[model samples]
Target chain A: MTSSNNTDTRLMTGNEACAEAALVAGMRFFAGYPITPSSEIAEVLARKLPSSGGVFIQMEDEIGSIAAIIGASLAGVKAMTATSGPGFSLMQENIGYAAMTEVPVVIVNVQRGGPSTGLPTLPSQSDVMQARWGTHGDHPVIAVVPSTVYETFVWTIKAFNFSEQYRVPVIVLLDEIIAHINEKITIPAHDELAIIDRTLSSQPPESYLPYKNTPSGVPLFAGFGTGYRYHVTGLCHDETGFPSSNARIVEELYLRLNRKIDQHRNDIIEYQTLDLDDAEICIVAYGSSARSAQRAVRIARQDGIKVGLFKPFVLWPFPGEELAELTRKAKTIIVPEMNLGQIAHEVSCATRKDVVSVNRVDGTLITPQEIVKRIYDVQV
Target chain B: MSFRYEIRLSGSGGQGLILAGKILAEAAAIYDNKNATQSQSYGPEARGGSSRSEVIISDEEIDYPKAVNIDFLLCFTQEACDKYCVDIKEKGILLVDSDYVTKVPEGKFTVHKVPITTIAEKQAGKSLVANIVALGIITGLTGIVSKKAVESAVLSRVPKGTEDLNTKAFNLGIDLARELK
Candidate 1:
C-alpha cells in the first residue's frame, strides 16, 4: 500500500505539503484568500495548480473563498480553501451552508491565537472547538489535525476522501508551527494513493432525488449541469430536494445528517497511542502538542514513571470511545494543549475521571519538561 | 557521534539563511537517512530585518522541532550574532562572516571567522551564493553531514542555470575551512 512510482524525498513546509496532497487527491479547484501562516498554501497552489490544469482563484475575502469552493464542489470538482483565525471566523457562515447542503469541500484553517485577530504569526490550538462548532446549527463535523509535515500530506488526502465519502465539508486544522515548519517527506506516486471521488446518482433525471435517504444516510450527490435538475439550498429540505416546513420532515433531515457521520465513526476516527499497556499516567494531546507529549512520554518511561501518550489526529466526532478505553486503566490523565484547556473538558467527560490540564495560551509551545514536571506532581 | 546536532543560521532576512538551513536539513534527512526538522523566525519586514533559521538533525525522530541547545551557529550579520549567541551550547562551534560582522562577542564557544560575502563575490562572482558557501563551510568544519550529500542537496535547490557558480563557491568555502584548521 505504501509503494510508489516516484519516491523522491523533498523538504517542504506543512502548508506546501497540504497543497501538494490536495492536488494529488484530484483537487482541480482552489479558492482561498491570503492569510498569514496559511497564505503559503494558497501561494504554492497558485503557481502549481495552473500547470496541472487546475484552477486557482484568490477570492475577494474569506467568505467568498469558501463560497467559491462550495460552488466548485457542486460543479463536480474537488475543491479547497485555506485561511487563518480571522479569515476562518469569516468563513463560518459559508461553512455552515456547505454543511446543510451536504456539499463536499475541504477547508484548511492554519490556526493562530485568537478570539479576534489575537496573534497572526504565532501558533495556537485554540480553534479546535471552532472547527467542531464554529459554523451554526447542529450539523456533524469532521476535522483532522496533523502534527508532522508528513502527516499533513497524508491527512490532507484523507480530508478530501472523508468529505466526499460522507458528503460533508472537512476541515484540516493546522497550528502556525506545523504550518510553517519545513521537514523532509517522501511523496508517493499518483498511482499509489487512494483517491476517492463523490458518488453520483445512477437514477435517471426524472427519479433522481438529490437528497434521497439511503442505508448509510449519505445521499448520492449529482453535480449541476449533469442532467439532474435538483434544487439545493441551506434551508431544511425533504428527500425530494425541496424545502419543507413540516416538523417531521425537518427532524428526519437533521437526524439523518447527524447519523450519516455517527454511524460511520469507526471509519472516521484515527488516533495514535504509545505505552498505554501498563501505564498509570496518560498524557492526551493533539496537533503540535502531541510532538512534545511524545518526547515527554519517552523521557518519563526512561525514568520508570509509567507514563504514556494518546494523540487524536481526528479532533471532531471526538474519539470518545477510544479515550474511554485508554483512560479506564490509567490512574491519572494529563492533557496539554496550546489553548486554555479546550479539549481537556472533553477528556474529563469521556473518561468520567479527574483530568489535569496543562494549558499555555501565551503563543509558546508547551515543552516536554513542563509535561514531565506535571507528571511528577501528579505522582505525589 | 552525538544523538542530535542542532545548527542555527542567523543573519539579515535577505541573506538566504533560511534556504541554507533547509538545504542542510534535507541533506541530513534525505541523503544521510537521519531525522531532521527546520524552522525559522523573522520580523515583519521582508528584508533587513533580523532573521534566524534552525535545523535539528537527530538519530531518532525529532520530538520538538525547534533547536534548544545549538551545536553550531553561523551568523552573517553582527546583530544576529549578538542576539542569538547566548543560546549556543557551551564549547559549541560559531562561524561568522568576517566582511559584515566585525565584532566577535566574547563567549565560551569556539569562533571561526571567514569572509563569506567576499568569497562569494570575488570567487563565485555573485554574493547571493554566500549562503551556499556557508553551507559548505559548516559541513566541512563539523562533518555533521557528508560533503557528497550537501553537494547533491545544493545542486537540487540552487536555481537552474547558476549551478556552476554555486558549486564553485561551495568548493571555495570548503577549501577555506580546511586552511583554517
Candidate 2:
C-alpha cells in the first residue's frame, strides 16, 4: 500500500494511515476536536474528506465531536471521531448513548498519560480500562488496539466493520507513540478491502423496527429521514427502540447486546502469538507496549531464554481463552503495559497464574530493555 | 540475523529534521524495499524548543520504533548534540552543524563537523533546506540508502515549487560528504 493509490508504498504516520483507511472503509463523515497526537487524523480528514465527497466538521469540543459523529451515523453515513485521553473522557456519555441506541459509530482514542490530562504530548496506554469501562453501565464494548502504523490502518477499517455489522460503537485505542510514529504502509486496493456496511431494513416503514432482534441478535438499521419512523433512546429499550422499564424486556435487551459480541467471539476477536510453542516464559502485551515486548522476546530468545509474546489486537473481547491456551506450556507470564497493571489483572484472571507486572505510568514508552529486565527477573 | 540501522535527527523546531527523517525512512522503506520506522518527540514550543526525529531501517520487521542504538546522529543544536551523543553506538557517525552546534562532546563515535545551516543559506538560497542538505550528507556518508532513492524521496516530499532548491541543497550535501571522505 502506498500514499494515494493501493500500489504505491509510501511513508505515513499512524494518524494519517488511520484517516486514509477510514476513507477506504467508506467513512463519509468525520467530527473531531484538535487534540495533540490525534489532531493529525482530523486534519488529514479535513483536507481529504471534502475532496472525496465526505464531510469533515471541527466541533466545539470533544463532547460535540463525538455527538456529531453519532448524529452522522444515525443519518446513514459511516462516521468517526478521534481524540486523546481528555477528549476520550469527555465523550464517555455519548459513547454509552451510542452503545445503548445501537448506533454503529467508530470512536478513536489516541491515548495520552493521565487520570486528568497528565501528559498531552507523550504516549501512554493508561486508557485500557477507561476504554472498556469509562462509558458507564454494563454495555458490551468492542475496542481494538493497534501496535503499528500498518495495524492502525488495518484495524481502523475493522473497527468500522465491527460497528456496522453488530450495530454497536467500536473504539480504536492508539497511544501517542503509535499515533504519531511514521511507517511505510501500502494502502490496499479498494476491491481488496472488505467493507461491511450497515444492514438496512427491507421491511416497509410501518413494519420496520429500528432495534428489532433477529437470529444474530443484531438489529437492522433504518436511517433517520429514510422513511423509517422509529423511536431511538439511550434508556433501556425493547426491540421497538422505545423506552421500556419492564424487567424482562430490559434484561433481554442487555443480554442480546452482550451475546451478539460474546457468542461470535471467534469471528470478532483477533490476536497474534509469537514463539509460544516451546517457550517457558510468555509476554502479554498490546498496542505500543506490544512492540517493546516483541523486541524483549527476541532479545530473551537470543540469550537462550525460552520467551514468547502474546499480542491482542482486539482488546475488549480480551482473547483470554487464546492466551490461556497458547501459554499452557509457559512456566510464567509477563504483562507489560504503560499503565500500572490495567490489563495485567485480566491476564492473571484468565490464566489462573500470577503474572509479573511490568508497568510505567510515565509519559515515555516502556523500553525493550525494561521489559527484558522484567523477563529475566521472572525467568528465575 | 538481519541488520538494523538507526538514525536520529535532532534540532530545534523549524529545522525540518522531522521531514528529513521521513524522507530518509521513505527512501529505505519505499524505494530500497527495506523496512523502516520513524518516530519523533518535540517540546510544546512551536520553534526553538528541542525536536528529535528518529528512524530505524532494518532488513527485518522493526519490533520497536524508537532508536536505542543509534548508528548515525545528526545534531543541529548543541543541546541536542550533548543530550543524544551518549546514545550513539561505538564507532557510529555523528554529524553536526558546525554553525550552531559548537563545543562537540568527545565520544566513542566519529564526528563530522560541517557548517550545514551556512551551506544551506549560501548554496540552497535559504537555511530552510538545511534538513535536505543533512539528508544528502547522511546518505552520502553512511550509504545506508541509495542516492537515487534519497533524491526521489526528497523530490516527492518537498513542496512543488521548491524541488529545484531542495535538489541543489541535497546535492551540495552529498558532494560535501564525498569531499570529507
Residues B82-128, model 1: lDDT tens digits: 88889889989899999988999998999999999988998889999
Error of 2 at B59 (Å): 1.2
Query: Going through the candidates in order, what is the number of backbone clashes in each?
Result: 0, 5
Tens digits of lDDT, candidate 1, A1-380: 11112576777899999999999999999998898889999999999999999999988999999999999999899999999999999999988999899999999999988989887777899999999999889988899999999999999999999999999999999998899888878887678789899898899989988999999999998898888788888999998878998999999999999998999999999999999988899999999999999988988888989999999989999998999997788999999999999899999889987799999998778888899999999988
Task: Tell me the TM-score of model 2.
Answer: 0.97
For every model shown, what is its TM-score relative to the native structure? 0.95, 0.97
Per-candidate iRMS values, in order, are 5.0, 2.7
True-contact fraction in model 1 equals 0.55
Candidate 2 docking quality: incorrect, acceptable, medium or high: medium
Candidate 1 CAPRI category? acceptable
Which window of ten consecutive residues has the lowest lDDT sum in model 1 chain A? A1-10
Candidate 2, position B82, lDDT: 91
Highest TM-score: which candidate? 2
